[model samples]
Target chain A: MMSDKEPLFSAKNRKLLTNPLGSDNPITIQVLGICSALAVTAKLEPAIVMSISVMAVLALANVIVSLLRNTIPSRIRIIVQLVIVAALVILVDQILKAFAYDVSKQLSVFVGLIITNCIIMGRLEAFALGNKPWPAFLDGIGNAAGYGIILVIVAFFRELLGSGTLYGFKVIPQAFYDMGYQNNGLMILPPMALITVGIIIWVQRSRNKSLIES
Target chain B: MNTQSNTYTFLYAAIMVVIVAAVLSFTSLTLKDRQNMNKEIEKKQNILKAVNVTSTPANAVELFDKYIVEAIIVNSEGEVKSNDKAETFKVDLKHENKKDLSKRKLPVFVFNDTKVGKKLIIPVRGKGMWGPIWGFISMESDRKTIYGATFDHKGETPGLGAEISKPEFQKPFTGKQIFDESGVFTSLKLVKGTASNNPHAFDAVSGGTVTSKGLEAMLQDNLSSYEKFLKSSK
Candidate 1:
């Protein structure tokens, strides 16, 4: 029996888990999931839902792809990945429509748009295609968390400043509005999401010099 | 056996497709009942919303049964037919909207408004900027003036066309006359800029011209089915 071999959360696996949340961030650094980040971040509720949906889909797809890695033909692997992602996305959409009608209403077609999110395919092609099932699952969760972190951060600022609310709660007091405080309407617009992402990237790079490129 | 052979690739793709298809269908079928229940509750909520009722999904059914007094189907001749609440509540607006006005069976919900007394709510369906838009408009006892309205859309652009569902956009519809003094059905107008000094007009949503226009048309077309009922009932 292997004595005290590499732990499940091995140093390398831990790096796989943590790296995506920082220097190799999916949204800030890799810019893989910017479209949904911009679209769903207008409201915190949808952002959280989208984040959770992506996390679930990504982790499941990764495990499935990793299991089929050997038998997958290189030429048709992309299609196979797409099929897996699309199926998972539809299932998620159905569940949301059943249980989260209001949220699903706001999300509308964006739930279906999850199929187009680059991060799922990117992870499947880059990591899952060549990795073991366990490592692939970790990579999926890590990358999705990286994307979700940015989504939540962007949504936090957007909903608070743009709507004067957090997750539809009136956190910004009515007194502020009565005293001539104004919500920045631009924050709710899609361009502001891009700008917010850029600002996050800026702050992160400045803090960690290793993240900056020459 | 050549691992890279086309036969192997074809088999792999075939098997994958079959598995994905089976799983997706199973999920969809299992969830169909729950999804339909959600839709029914939301429909109740929207109808209730048109009459200034606030309800969550948990309480929507109870509130709907308590508030909605009767559901009736009316034809283009404005003749009220069957009053089966269950059957009428389940009528598909899209399917009915496609039929010729003369043959279409329009479903109307009679809501006993605590504030305004009795109001009849007619559901309207139309196109929006990006997708389908629909809502319920409750007319006062006179059946000529709007008591309240609620609009919802599938995929209208937020902050623009989607503003139709907002309180500010819908508030103006109240007390607005849908018909002229001479009893001519002019249908309410959606003034683009402002609706000041207009007894029969409401302000169209800014930056949501298509959705606004769609709502206007939807109200006019759908309401015409109740013309005779309104005239006779009055």
Candidate 2:
């Protein structure tokens, strides 16, 4: 029930979604969600799935927390956020088990660990607590999408070079193997994920001059 | 308004605890049936994997009903125990761990098949590269040939040691004999080379050295206990 003076869907509110992708991206600008970016980016399929799951959780959690901001006491705001996040994570885990058992098994503890992912907590505290629900939800989605874009790119190269495959399908021809072209096994390791992400940031920064400082 | 007593603090804490407990209890009760069903389905799925049958959770029960004919509880000596009060499937491995080895209830699943009329499925669990590895080994009616096998691990590296769970890795176990003609026990071993001409040995993964060894150890340790039962049943 926003007043006419404060429009529900203003230009500034719309900017919340697009701004995070370029100028004020959570990954490049704030440097959040880097841990997951480095862990699950070994394979394109897992990285994509992880990114979507994170986005859904963050956006929904932000909207819910923003809606309940008034009821949360200042002294116990953090506790309330944690409780809500934990409950939501459990629900998500249950849904995954019921619907997508194999993928859920593959994800295992990572889904449960979403509660500890700092980005969700940071967004809730820094933006959702003060902003209206719509804007906060948009911000959450925008930041998640930005993070997802970087992860997918990193996973693409890693999976291609490391396993010579994409989305679990053999992409590199059999001739490549017969010609003694072996997979770069190092690319499948966690350290390679870090180096790949670092290279992505380097390329992105070099191309986009403004992102250099951030 | 004055700072008189701490009654407010105590009351608030008490109310919060009661609310939380009630919520937890309600949630647990509501999901209890579904959780149990999921567990049953998961168990059936694992059993089917043991017999080289692949099926999703949705069709696990159907496949299990089609393949699994009977289940029995046997002692370490391989004798059928009249523990009618306790179902073989309901035997908890964790509870069996603390008890004396001789007293543990071992579940033996019998599968019905045209090729192998009745096969014995034994469950095995032990330490692996990262965490516990478990599997079910189904022996053919002759008690020598392996009907099928399945293995699973927790936290093992994917595409490496974790490949043990894949059918490509497990397929070698089928038709491999577990005992010599002299009734001498020669359990399957994860060999370094190709599967030996001798029926008792199976080839191990080259790169997954530790996990292969772990599988070998797990098979020997868990399956050895069933030898007495196996011998008597024969």
Best by lDDT: 1
Model 1 chain A poorest 10 in a row by lDDT: A1-10
lDDT of 1 by residue, A3-72 (tens): 7666899899999899999989999888898898998899898888888889999999999999989889
Best by DockQ: 1
True contacts kept of 1: 0.73
All candidates: DockQ: 0.73, 0.28
Candidate 2 falls in which docking quality class? acceptable
B74-171 in candidate 1: lDDT tens per residue? 78787777899998998898999898878888888999956769988989898888889999999888889888999999888877898988898888
Error of 1 at A188 (Å): 1.9
lDDT of each: 0.89, 0.79
Highest TM-score among the candidates is held by which one?
1
Model 2 chain A: weakest 10-residue lDDT segment is A1-10
